[model samples]
Target: MKRPSAWHLVLAPLALLFALPLLWLLVSSVMTNAEINRFPPALIPSGIDLGGYRYVLGNALFPRWFVNSMIVSAVAVTANLAFGTLGGYAFARIRFAGSKLMLGMMLATMVIPFQLTMIPTFLVMKSLGLIDTLGALIIPSLVTPLAVFLFRQFFVSLPRELEEAAWIDGCGRLRILVSIVLPLARPALSTVAVLTFLSTWNDLTWPLIAINSDSNYTLQLGLTTFQGQHHTQWAAVMAGNVITVLPVLLGFLLAQKAFIRSLASTGLKG
Candidate 1:
């Protein structure tokens, strides 16, 4: 193992500062719902209780919402990885008329806030009879412009020699992409996958607009049901919030190495 750099030492405190909130959430979740609602929030739990987890998992709609979120995130990640890579490769390696214009248009779409297109997007989904369905969530987020951009940037840094070598080996473009280019593009692929998963998992607005059925609700959307116009269950709400956040936290923890390596590799490529 290598020794820690001076910069690592200097940044240790900053890292902890950023992580404190997450640590608090994890700790608070184990506390009784009553403990969480108390004044001057309890940083430590008196006793670990599974009640919070029970409430969230046992809720009539939570399990369905969980499954919905998982499906959306999984499908979105797969689409982003496949289409984003192909799109990125085209933008980086392929030459054709209006290629630059098309990329620019895609980038322009990213600039337009989702809020501006929310109603129109919802209307489109409704017209397609996709309302109250997972298709509405999965289709719109299948491949985002940002994912394409990230992959394109990373792909540009790759040497053309590899693709050419694959061609010399009598591999077709699709075969080269699948067997040669993709294997080496793991860093960028991991980055795109992690980002797409996180975004689709946490997305609330589109799900709220697209899904009206309880069975199709996402974790974020289901969490909102814990709140009422007249009375809010703060404890259960916090519990749900904790439940909603756990998968993201666990996913990041398990994939942090790949994620950071991707960023570092991309930065060096730039």
Candidate 2:
């Protein structure tokens, strides 16, 4: 059997260091509030206490928040994948006047921080009467420059011969894209889907600004209500966080292979 290298020895502890918090969170979620607040926190609980999870799940507002987050995330992922893939395919395969210039302008927007555009986005949402609605959260994040860039790069790396062959078969551009190109672009599509889902699922800042009504709050925004000025519910907060993180973790685990493959292939081509 081959022996482990020095690099593994160096990295193992670092990996564990980063994993400790997640481990702690999982452990702490089952702990009592009293156990959590003890002078020296218990690494392991005396007994499993599921009160936090029970409370969160039983709460009337939590289910609504969960549903809202799911709706927004689903819409965001669908919109980003559909639009980003189309825009990316166009930039990769189609040649038009000022295409390069337009692509450059789109890429440049990525460098502009979200904070700079937040006010303008909020105002626009207000003007459209989307404020305090799920639309406020979903509209602004439907697609991103990064998703477009990833799709374009992956599309560029594909052989032109395949597309040309489809064209020779009398396939129109949209037909070629949907029938030939997208079927082979699974990795890129998976990467975009996973990324869009994660971003929309975890987004808190924009929702905070755009949504005022408690009923419309996303999971992240709803979780904030657990923290009070005088006392915070650590167990409930941790339980809520675990619930919030599970979907993203499960999503990545399912799509991680394609995500990595797409990123590696995109980077190599670039």
Candidate 3:
């Protein structure tokens, strides 16, 4: 038998460290209030309690909030993919006036804190009559600089010969992008999609500031109701958070291989 690798000793501890919070969340969701409030905090519950799940699921508005989150995430992901892909491809291949300046400007915006732009974004959404609506959330996130940058990096590494050959065959630039470029960019596409979905689904701050109507609240925003000035429902909040994150967690797990592959490929080549 082969001797154990030394890396296992280091990795095992690190893995547990990262997993601790999520493990705590899962276990605490099923623990009684008395059990959870114990001084040391219970890692294992003596008995399971469904009180949290019941509390959250019993609320009629929960379903509406879930649907609202789904709509916003779906639209944001689709819009980012469509627009980011095009913009990235242009930055990667097409030579246009001030293209480098534009790319630099776009990348620069990514460094600026979102907190600085929130008020201006809210005002813009209000002027467009999108405030207090799902559109308010969707419109601002339709495309992001990170998404565009990822696509551009991935596209830049693609072989010019393939695009040239397509051009020789009289294929239009758009057609070439659709047929030749995108097929090979599956890994990047998957990465962008998963990232976009995760961001949009988990976003609460902007939605909170923009949407006053409870009916328009996203899942993350709706989960906040479990807490109030006097009473805080820890169990329900924990359970609601679990439900809120479940889809994003599952999507990441399923797409993790592709996601990692995309980033690695992008980093190495382009």
The per-model lDDT (C-alpha) reads: 0.83, 0.86, 0.87
Tell me each candidate's TM-score: 0.83, 0.90, 0.85
Q: What is the C-alpha RMSD of each candidate to the true structure, in Å?
A: 3.9, 2.4, 3.0
Q: Write the per-residue lDDT of candidate 2 for residues 1-270, one digit (tens) a residue.
A: 988798988899999999999988888888889987888988789998998898888887887899999999999999999999899999999999999998999999988998999999999999999999999998888889888999998899999998897798888888998998999988788888876787799988999999998899899899887545114567877888789888987776777787576557647845
Q: Model 3 — TM-score against the truth?
A: 0.85
How far residue 251's Cα lies from its native spot in candidate 2, in Å, is 2.3
TM-score of candidate 1 against the unseen true structure: 0.83
What TM-score does prediction 2 earn?
A: 0.90
Cα lDDT tens digits for candidate 1, 86-181: 999889988899999999999889779889999999999999999999999988999999889998998899899989977888887788878888
Q: Is candidate 2 or candidate 3 better by TM-score?
A: 2
Winning candidate number (TM-score): 2
List, residue by residue over 81-157, the lDDT tens digit for candidate 3: 99999999999999999999999999999879989999999999999998999999988899999899999988988
* Segments of candidate 3 deviating more than 4 angstroms: 3-14, 32-43, 229-232, 260-270
lDDT accuracy of residue 19 in candidate 3: 99
